[model samples]
Target: MAVNLQKGQKISLEKEAGGALSRVTMGLGWDVAKSGGFFGFGAKSQAVDLDASVVMFDESNRPVDVVWFRQLKSRDGSITHTGDNRTGAGDGDDEQIVVDLRTVPESVRSLVFTVNSFTGQNFSTVQNAFCRLFDTSNGKEIARYDLSVQGSHTAQIMAKLYRHNGEWKMHAIGENGSGRTFDDLMPLIVPHL
Candidate 1:
């Protein structure tokens, strides 16, 4: 069964399966809202070039690696980005990051998921935005967090997957921010990390 996560909610990766979640994938999806043009005329909805990324941080919160459009795979081969999605017109995941949890280096303690509008289109024009975690082995959705809240922000700090006392857990953040890329979101992300 899939769990709908509320902001700040944290859940174990193992669920009731009695075994560790060895491989998981984070999926992000969104669509641009059709806008009524000037003077109440219909204008074609613009495509939102939203990008999903993961930043790996060490124990002290120092960034160790990043998996994004430009860098599809982590140096150690634990994290891999499927590919870039120019348009969010698909039925399923528009962007996905797969992680071999057990293969992650011991030095890397946490992973942060972020989504940004590279075209600078604010969330107010985006609809049906969501982030989800799935067990790759079974293709079962483990947890999902809605990122479709109405706001003027251009990006969001979606969630965090981290190691806690020998177990992997996920925390829903759903915090909005103004950023076109991960670099622009660093300041806002620091306070939360």
Candidate 2:
């Protein structure tokens, strides 16, 4: 069974999945809100180019590597991105980042998942945005975070997966910010780590 996570909620992956997980995927999805054309004539939906990224951080909260649309994989090959989804069209996850947890370097302490509109479209133009984590071994969703807040911000610091006492855990971080890329999200992410 999948757990719906609230903002700031934390969960132990081991307990939620019934055991240890070797691989997991962070999936992000969203839809573009329709705009009422001149005098409500033609309501149309524009394509939203939202990019999902994962920033690997070390023990001191320093970024070790990042896997995003531009860089599809981490330096060590432990993390891989499923590519960018410019339209946010169709169903399910628009973008996905897969992590081989076992192969992640010991020096990398946390993985921060983030979503941003490379096209500069704010959240007000988006709808039904969400981030989810699932066990890759059995294709079971373990946790999901719905981004229900709509605003002028262009990006969001979605969630964090970190190691705690040799066990993996997840934290829901629904912080909104204005950014077109991962570099712009660095400051907003530091406080959460």
Residue runs of model 1 more than 4 Å from their true location after superposition:
16-18, 37-43
Q: Write the per-residue lDDT of candidate 1 for residues 1-193, one digit (tens) a residue.
A: 7889999999988963246788999999998887888765776788888999999999999999999999999999999999988778978789999999989999998999999999898998888989999989988889999999988999999999988899898899888898888878888778767
**lDDT score for residue 7 of model 1:** 98
True-structure lDDT of candidate 2:
0.93
lDDT of each: 0.90, 0.93
Cα-based lDDT at residue 39, candidate 1: 69
TM-score of each: 0.94, 0.96
Candidate No. with top lDDT: 2
Query: Highest TM-score, which number?
Result: 2
Candidate 2 per-residue lDDT, tens place, 130-193, comes to 9999998888999999985889899999999999999999999999998999899999999999
Ten residues in a row with the worst lDDT in model 1?
13-22
